[model samples]
Target: MTEGRKLRPEERILWGKVAKSTRALRARQDEVAEYEAEITAMLAAEEAALARPAPPQDVVSPPGNQLRAPRPAPSHQPLEKPVHRKLAKGRLSIEARIDLHGLFQDEAHDLLLDFLFRAHERGMRHVLVITGKGSSMGSEGVLRRTVPLWFSKPEFRFLISSYEWAARHHGGEGALYVRLSRPRRSL
Candidate 1:
């Protein structure tokens, strides 16, 4: 530990090598400590998991099989399917007329429904619809064509059995002939 001392070349080299080895050993020790700390943390986490309760898992079941609690019966009977026609041909068993003149969309919808219900109730075979030639309204008949689109929606579909452009004598392009399902007479 002299403050100033001349060293042999070989001695200086040996001392340098020894210092390098010592630094490498210290680095290895640090790595080993880090690995040990990681393992210890992992073990603590496992122990914590073991101390907690496990959540319940649903039972595995095959397709179409599920475990469920019993439910009470419905208060009312399910509705029977209303009888309807499957074909479109001459003269519907019931008919309805709709006039779109100045009615707004919803207004026209309510009117159409009313006409259908009345026609069905009365057992009328076929009816006519006079939407009025839309040309006069500056629409070039856009709404007139749209009426059929509305009729084709699922809600209104069940009411109509078939439809066609009205006969020339009946109003032609300005009107339609709608056929509806006749109400079933329950014995």
Candidate 2:
């Protein structure tokens, strides 16, 4: 190994090249080792997670002795009384409306979901959903029956504060006055 001795230009160039190559190799080895350590830690964490037992889920036995998963608890707190009063009076102006008069059940469901999602994202507070009084069809309105059930579903429930039949002027039994949850601000 050479100490502080001055060397020929060619020798100096070769030595500098050797030093650079050695430093690069060491840095690469360090990077590989760091990656290996991270991968190992992740694998160990995954294995531990798998080994742990899952928490117990609530199960309910239905009327026909069929077991079913329990519905999640409602996420939204009850609406204030003044809000309810305004809604009932049709004072809280509707920001958006969707009429499901002509669509099939599946189509209505999809459209309603999309409408609510978009309304909520846009910071809409009051929206009207018209399902029409099923006068020609029979005694019960198909959409009227299904709409409330759909609102209670997990996907829709989070976005809704509360809902009720619209005032007679709005559409009476045929339409719903939906109050949407406030849009969450992104970080």
Top model by lDDT, which number?
2
**lDDT of all predictions:** 0.60, 0.78
Summing lDDT over every window of 10 consecutive residues in candidate 2, give the lowest-scoring window: 70-79
Q: Write model 2 residue lDDT over 82-148, tens digit each, in one string.
A: 8766877767778899999757899999999999999999999989999988654233677886787
Cα lDDT of model 1 by residue, 1-187, tens digit: 7556545656655765676565336759889788879977975875566456455555666678876744422122111223122112333332445677656668787888788777778887566777766554234464466566656555566566666666565667777766665677899
Error of 2 at 15 (Å): 98
- How many angstroms is residue 74 displaced in model 1 relative to the true structure, after the best TM-score fit? 28
Task: Estimate the TM-score of every prediction.
Answer: 0.46, 0.57
Which stretches in model 1 have alpha-carbon errors above 4 Å? 1-96, 185-187
Candidate 2 segments exceeding 4 Å error: 1-72, 75-81, 88-90
